[model samples]
Target chain A: MHEEDRQLVRTLIRGDAAAFRNFFDDYFPRLFRFILRRVNGDEESARDVVQSALIRAVRKLDTYRGEASLFTWLCQVTRNELADQVAKSVRQETYMRRLVDLEDDPQARGILESIPAGGEAEPESVRQREDLAALVHAALDYLPSKYARVLELKYMEDLSVEGIAEAMGVTAIAVQSLLARARVAFRDVGETLLPSLGGNW
Target chain B: MDTQPDPRADEPPTDDLARLIRRAGRRPQPDPEMHAAVRAAVEREWSAHASHGGRRGAMVLGVAAALAALAIGLSWYSLHPGAPAGSAEVGTFVAARGPVHVAPTDGHEMVVAGSRLNAGSSIETGPAGYALLTVASVAARLGPGSLLKLNRPGHVELVRGRIYADSGSPSAPPDALVIDTAFGQVTHLGTQFQVRVDPEAMSVSVRDGKVLVSQGGGRSITIDRGQGLRVSSDGEVSRLNVAPYGANWAWVSEFSPNFPIDGRPLSAFLSWYARETGLTLVLRRPVTQADLDRPTLSGSITGLSPAQALAAVMATTQFEYDMTVPGELRIESRATRGAN
Candidate 1:
């Protein structure tokens, strides 16, 4: 794993544009989802944090020693960026104070309670579903990139077995075998990591 | 790895696990525009590192070039002791506004904060441009529509427009500032003064201390504190009394160097406010030295004029200020005020 990441870092530092695009496409979405969940699905804040982190990572690419996988290192950088963003927001307390005031107001609370929740699903079920979705994404992040990518293509993209094979550059039989292992892996990891969300599975 | 193959292997499982896996796909993704912006920024950084063999190497080259320039400047200065100072860094721009440009060589570049300004550089301010620079030991503030050439440390040529120079306090002044104009040369004697060069006349206003305006042929006139001297194109001179602090000096206060108040005491901020406004700071009775030095400030006061910054900083403390007296800022404890 370290050797593979070392090769990727070398390609990135050599200014291989196509290699950079592949690296970006491979990691950016995963990191984005990782941060989005943590930021309570604030897409703008997540984007800002991830964008700054990725740029910072690229600028400091030569420092990658391959001691950890490239994704893990990127996550470390993203965490720092997120921490800085949180600090800046805390320092600008006017907005935070307004939010606190709104939360404290009984009239505002009454108005919020009066508004009907969206969608046909009950609010609790919707929240549970959202939490389960976030947990699944987190579990996928922990999986090997190949396992995560294959699963995403099959389920989220609704890609056929042949399509998954084409995307992964493998034979259909290999795709099928990977999918079987990926599913088992996902279930095992999810059950271990989040029993509440993965209890039924 | 428990690779337990079920009978339903290689097929889509119609179990709760499959539903959850599909739900993960619905997780929020990044916005397309934001994604593209990030990619562009990353690629740009990668290209910079690739082309320059990393920023560290580029920084080394920058430092090496700066050292070589310094060496050449030192050699030139040593060879000609009586000549103007060699082309070396003499000051740094502390603050700038609007379209301030510094022509260090033949071409001009937009001035940025903390940029080193070398000797022989010409600074020009646009109609809305205002700049505050610390040249050597003096702080020079250039107003809009001005063109000033830095000859050397403590000396500058004012081609046109207005410039204010503060050589610090009279008790312990820095290097005296000399402003050469078309009419005559105005040199400060450890003072704070404003020099304005118009098409028809050049005027020197002394806000503090005194300055000597020298016409050619050994003729000179001393302008005392609170006095202004205007010399016409034909060498006609007129003197007038000008207030040290008023609307006339408001523009100078607008572009004053920002006093970083974080972790600084209230007394330090008050002193800065007094100096910037040319007002005498007076702590009224009951406001002891300990009271003024007790509270430490936090946060920034950037982008505010001197007066506005003072008000904002004072509001965070238990002190109240009164500017009712002309050219005096009286500060007292709020508790003292309430008791009175």
Candidate 2:
């Protein structure tokens, strides 16, 4: 996977137009969703931060060593950009205040601690459902692109196995196998990350 | 593989999980305009990097060229020990406020006091920013919303906004600070002057001494002390009488370079105050030259405006000051106060 990402980066640095487009199209939306969650869904601020991160990443493309997947590296860069934006702006106070409140409130702490390991049960309230959605999206963000795409094709697009295979250009059997792996990956990552949100997911 | 039961065999049905996943995916995507703008900016950066074979290569090349130049410069300096090193650095920022930025070859970086500016550098002030630099021995102040480029030691291009230049005392040899603008070129003749550029016109106002404004087609106008000249975009010229001090000159003192008062003579502080405020300094009869030359000042007057510094510094001396005549500050012995 890293070798494939390095090859794509080489093509991008060589000024291949199609490679550049694919790079932006593949990672930009995922990175945007990743940052949007952190910025309390302020879409405009998220867009600005994502744009700055992508521009910086492209400029520093030659420095990418492929030690991590390209999307993970991009997320690191986006986090730095988000941190800079937060420092430079007073507008993130509401988002920051909610995080502080979460740290202090025992009820919020209890909700986070009560989340089951498998994450199979439905959330108890409408608010928890919204938080669950955010956790699911964040989990999808952490997955490999192929896994995330296959899962999205299956669940969000409401595609049958044959439809997922057609969209992914794979066999129906392959789609089923990828779906099985994706579901487990989603559950494992969500279990690890959801608690960190402290009931604000 | 055969021993492991299918992971999906015990998995819950897809109906409920699909709803959750679909709801998560419903978050907002980038708007079309923002997507396009980001794509455009990213592609531009990618092209820049690609054209240079990536920034790493460009940086390596830049370093190599700099090293090669340094080697030659060092060899030349070795043979000529008395000669000055050839450096592009033209000045150091004496004061800066708000978001004053300096861009050399790479990109813009915020400037602070003591920031060295090279000859080819560009200085830009944010809407609330002000900066003071001594370039080529001339005190140059950039007003807010100004962009000035240092072309060489004594020449600059005023791209937009206002810049004030003080070419030291009238008796000193003129370094001839030349400023190029949209309307014409202004070269000061050992004087203090301001050049302002607006969208429709360019104006040059002189506070002391004189400056020669040369317009296109070989037309030239010499503006003396206390005069202002305006040239419209269509080349129409107008003149007006301006005062040497008052509300017009107040902004310059707001970010005036710090005056080090530690162990300095009282006369030196008064000299700085006079130049900064465009006021004449007069010592009354009882205030002897010996009194003015005494090094009695100690401590700091930092972060104080010119008027405040004047009051603070004067309160420590045996002299008092009066500004009853607008452009002149009178100093007299405290013992002789109100005797006139």
Candidate 3:
């Protein structure tokens, strides 16, 4: 670590609210955007993961050898949190898989089809769904955080133009213009990033 | 949905990503409350890190204070050699009535009130004897003729008698304090409750919070504050609704610890009184809870029972308390109490 970076780390250890607020304000938007994509746009889970990651990072500061940037360290911590979340959700995920498999039964399918899981009988299909969710998440990850966030809030979270404007502290008109540009950029990048899970788009 | 047309409406040239973006829409902004909550949590961590330099070095205020007290006592250990180690040094005991007998479960000789007992110790009270003890932060009173086995740090077993316990946190799922009984096991979730064991059955009562009674096999039920239940040796269960306060708690008064009220707020004293008596705290009009928040008394009401303590503490302030309901305590202004 550079001497300046070390000092910054020291300031973080001081545990002052103002210093923390400054750090949180600086990194939260970027972290939130990153997590939102990975969790398939589930806002609550994304927020939980982000909070856990940052808290863990703050506690483990002594291990910071400056081998990687602080942001990279945080991402590494987030990856671990994601793995834990994945493990915890195994039961629910299995149930979801069962629902998907039973989709062929009409009486049962009528009840289970709305479960929104990957195709049954094909383990590959399950992997594809998981991978596609990850691919889209990574694609969003590669975009400018703001553009990716707007697209996610719109499509993934189903927020309105006015709602997005209020969140971004911009006018509805500005949001639309950003959305138009973001869509073009996202398509440009997503084409290569997307796994070939029948890339109809 | 976008109300305005795409800025590049005329140039319809590119890829599927634009469609995807338009479809993916706005990412949900993190809730503002979550932002504050996480920031507060992280700030606590940062402060701890800054204070101690390492996680192992950090101890919360209560634990640190307790350890300091312990270190001071251990310093004098050299003067007193051959003292038996306390297997589960659950807090000290205060004799409330006739002599309280305490000895290791295997020992025949019983010691006096000042004597310390270990986890495997057996505590017995004579016909008129009463004893008060604290295990961790939990407060418990052993009624007259009661016998309890100090099994260990996390558990106390009722051999044959009644025991009143108040977890004292005023919250549910309190620290672990398991009360093992013949019919089953009884535990509390931060409650003021009582458990009695007889050869034929076990009875559990709640005054303020809750108690969990597990019977033989897998049967268990939660008895909330102001409720009571009985489990027969034959595995039958019956529930009863009981007053939160009154004579049922009178025996506990004999074992009430000397509460230090000097320089404490009236509210603190009142809360102690309510918990000890198992009544709801209801402050009368004109004597709001705020009135009790300020320091009122500078003298200790030491040695006074919970009821007597309340009287002494209330006399100084303008508030007077009475039981409007068996379970509810109404502490109104002196004027209001007098009027009714």
DockQ, every prediction: 0.16, 0.17, 0.14
Model 3 DockQ, alpha carbons vs. true complex:
0.14
Task: Please state what fraction of the native interface contacts candidate 1 reproduces.
Answer: 0.42
Here, model 2's chain A TM-score works out at: 0.72
Candidate 3 lDDT, B180-233, residue by residue in tens: 988889977787888877655777888877778887678889999779897876
For residues B203-280, write the lDDT of model 1, one tens digit per residue.
888889899999999999999899999887877899989888875576687577767899999889888888888899
Chain B TM-score against the true chain B, candidate 1:
0.70
| Native contact fraction, candidates in order | 0.42, 0.42, 0.38
lDDT scores of the candidates, listed in order: 0.72, 0.71, 0.63
Q: Which clashing pairs does model 2 show?
A: none
Model 3 C-alpha lDDT per residue in residues A138-168, reported as the tens digit of each score: 5676565568767766666656777775345
CA displacement after TM-score superposition, residue A201 of candidate 1 (Å): 85
Q: Which ten residues in a row have the lowest lDDT in candidate 2 chain A?
A: A165-174
lDDT of 3 at B287: 76
